[model samples]
Target: MTIIEQYGWNTVWKDKWNGKYREHEGRDLLPGRIIGDFGSKFRVITETGETWGELAGRLRHTMTDSGEYPSVGDWVLLAVQDGGEHAVIHGVLPRSSVISRKAAGNTRDEQIVASNVDTLFLVSALNDDFNVRRMERYLIMAWNSGANPVILLTKADLCQDAELKIAEMERAAPGVPVHAVSALLGDGREALLPYIRSGQTVALTGSSGCGKSTMVNWLSGRMLQLTQDVREGDSRGRHTTTHRELFVLPEGGIIVDTPGMRELQLWEDEGGLDLAFGDISSLAAGCRYSDCSHEREEGCAVLQAVAEGVLEEKRLLNYRKTQRELLYQSSKEVKQKRKSAAAAVKAGSSRSRNSGWRKEMDEY
Candidate 1:
């Protein structure tokens, strides 16, 4: 099959993207897919396999400061320009799915991790860097993205014991499948082969030094990129992959490689929290109070489990922490939107009043 056939974008291109989209009275343009990026520039591949394009200044002006810009795997429209070296992106097509996070630190903007992803591989190393709490954070984001989440427990060779580590992760993740693989030795790597089938799209993401790039190289059967061992002092790896990129596996599957992130901030995914702490949710449901906070509430089933030793305190603490973080983030986003809406209303009212005065002056 051709690129369109393999990517399943042919029909999408025909029905939704073939012509200009004039939603609410806007003009139209030709369509393309954002395949990669280079600082402030984009590389969009059209449905026809022609690649390398950039966004026009006019299109950039139309973009609201907050809406997600074109990310890898996003379908976009372009006005084919004069240069054989370039084309201008006019607009971004509707996205089916996107995995995102608030850009690390105090930035109030959401960063797109990847778009239109079929599966999310949450890679975690088996070394000292592995943290169950961190895995929980990844799971919540994956659940919110509407993509299936698969846990990849990498670097089996580094760990002294594999079974114990796997069991701990499984306990935290509950129903999720956890696979242990050693990129260095290739042990247990076969378990992940079935997922690399032709036509499927997967993305690799996790903390720095989790062997995500190594796994990518292993899958491609060549040294597609460089790899670095974790620092001996802290056991954290340096950021090797600088940007998000879509790579077609020689075997069959498509995978998006992402830069290692020490920080994966959560954005607006309430359901993700529910799915991540499902056990906690189930327990909290039986609380006498309909709106129980699960903190110091009398006759709380969640607390009862903790008292009975069925639930670990650390698990409950992590659940509460994640819930609070999401809640805070949601509240912050709401406030920002409210302030923006008020400003927009004020601006629109001013524009309307100005237009009325201008009409009167013209009549006189």
Candidate 2:
């Protein structure tokens, strides 16, 4: 197979690259895929082979945020140097799909986990790390990213009631495939093979101790990532995979493995919440008010469903919590935009006043 084909490249991406080709004009550049990121620099795989690439100075100066930089699974335009061992990234093609999460801690920044993914495996262990609420959050992110989500419930060997856990996850994530697997025992791996076909890209993401690396190793049929044991008391494991890296599975597809996130604060839901909690959103449509808060309000279909035992109360509560978060974030973004616009207006006004004052002085 050709290099681009091996790296999950196709005509759609080729069209995007063609658009960039026109923008670059006559530059001696080639298309490369980013497989690994090293802080300010990245490791790109071009048709020629693998190479370490750094962002061009102009690209760095113009980037308004980290998202503008090349990430794992990103296809970029680059200038190969030193016999193709090193390169300079000039541009990033439009992403087909991107998986992101709010940067950890108090910051409102969005951290790009992976880009250009076709499928997202929202892996969660059947052990203590499994939380239906967290899975719901991941489903929201998966839906928002525009990739198909398949919930992977790992460590079936450890869970006595693996089927029960899978059923519970199915409830939390409606209409999405939920598979139970034991990477150690090599069970249920075949169910995932259909998603990991040639010319497609898949991403594995979840919290620590969820056996993400183990899944990677099993699927790849090699020890591509290191694994650590989880604490017996809490089942929390250290961040075995510190950085996001893309690997070519011998089986015929590409996979991006990311570090376990401690918290996945949402950046934007973009109708992801509605899809993630479609049951709640569908019921919400029957509310008396168009903007019903669904909080102890009369004629609230959502609350009525909860009361009637049709919908789980905890699920509705979590849906409300996520909705409020998205609302607050949206408001904050709008406020920021307004503030920036006001500042620009004030600055323009000040400049105009100065210009008038200078004209008057010159006239005098």
Candidate achieving the largest lDDT: 2
175-271 per-residue lDDT for model 2 (tens digits): 9999999988989988988888898899999998899999999999999999999999998999999888999887789999999988788888778
Residue 110's lDDT in candidate 1: 84
What pairs collide in candidate 1? 20-28, 198-252
In candidate 1, what are the lDDT values of residues 297-337, reduced to their tens digit? Answer: 89899999999998888999998898888889999999999
TM-scores of the candidates in the order shown: 0.92, 0.93
Number of clashing residue pairs, candidate 1: 2
Residue 215 of model 1 has an lDDT of: 84
Top TM-score model? 2
Model 2 misplacement above 4 A: 19-25, 340-364
